[model samples]
Target: MTAPHDVPDLTGSGEYLVPDVLQPGLTLVLVGTAPSGISARARAYYANPENKFWRTLHAVGLTPRQLVPQEYATLPQYGLGLTDVAKRHSGVDAALPGEAWRPDELRRKVEHYRPRIVAFTSKRGASETLGVPTGKLPYGPQPQPLDWPAETELWVLPSTSPLGHNHFRLEPWQALGDRVRELRGAAEAGNPSPETPVL
Candidate 1:
């Protein structure tokens, strides 16, 4: 794992707009379908100012303060990280080729990193990873771990994209923060938080 102060190389194929910000021991990892066109050009995740990813993180108390998209690399310090299902491409989910959704790659990363929680920023991401239709995914913790290791949990959150504005709700994000806090509290108390919800 890269040290917190060391800049980890996130670069990949030319198709990759922005490199993935990932490492081991993350408390949470947010997966998206792909980068927005603007984000691709800007070399940042959720670079569009309109995207709610950064704002929601702060609002949910997941971060100490609101962070701009350019600050993504600093996430690991707070036990948070970012990645996408389609690392070799950038565009809206509907425009991407079916093969672009590489769930196995995501699984390998999660298994290697072993984060406490893995949350999909959009149902499409979760569906692609879990091999289920988006309609079947509910917002918040998922009961099944899919192919994830038993030590990790899964969560599905509504898309923060402007296109998903109709379904946007902050409740699930807040719940996620609460669960993280619960896990931290349990760990600090030297008790196992086995039943902590993935939400």
Candidate 2:
């Protein structure tokens, strides 16, 4: 069946937050496949009460130790920017069937933003987007670099969402935060990463 081409109502969905561009000091551009209802309503990424994104990022040190969702906008100040492949929201990613996978858009963003690292927040998103078999993927660092423009680095991160948990726990997220801070620091130094990093 041809799905209806209707824009989902975001009036109460969490807000969609995209920085004017990407933050300059970004060694990491945290890109999700899209937003969910809670995040749309909260106007923040992973705003669902159970979603552990900010908590994980903070735990990892990518964010400045804050617990409130409203503070999410400030992540760019720390050299992290937020975005998504699909701007619309569905309660679950599986519901977003046939959502166009635009690697070109991703590539364009990489070229434009020039972040040191581009991390995909969910393995499902990365797997679906890149067409990699689920079994062959690695933990933490990806086997190969991201195929984005301008030679951006890529890393596949374990998703912080409760639903996205393939395995592991909060400890790994803390490590991600530290990695983000390190890359942000590196980008600030002008020695950008050689590969497109996705998490």
The digit string of per-residue lDDT tens for model 2 on 31-94 reads 7877677776666667777777777776666766855666766766777776676665446777
**TM-score versus the correct structure, for each prediction:** 0.90, 0.74
Over the stretch 1-199, how does candidate 1's per-residue lDDT look in tens digits? 3233332233443456677777777788899998888998888999999899999999998999999999998998888889898887788889999888888777777777778899999999999888888888989988756566787889999899998899899999999999888887777899987595543
The residue ranges of model 2 lying beyond 4 angstroms of the native Cα positions read 1-21, 143-147, 184-199
Q: What C-alpha lDDT do the candidate models reach, one value each?
A: 0.83, 0.61
**Top of the candidates by lDDT:** 1
RMSD of each: 3.9, 6.7
Q: What residue pairs clash in candidate 1, if any at all?
A: none
**Over the full model, what C-alpha lDDT does candidate 1 score relative to the true structure?**
0.83
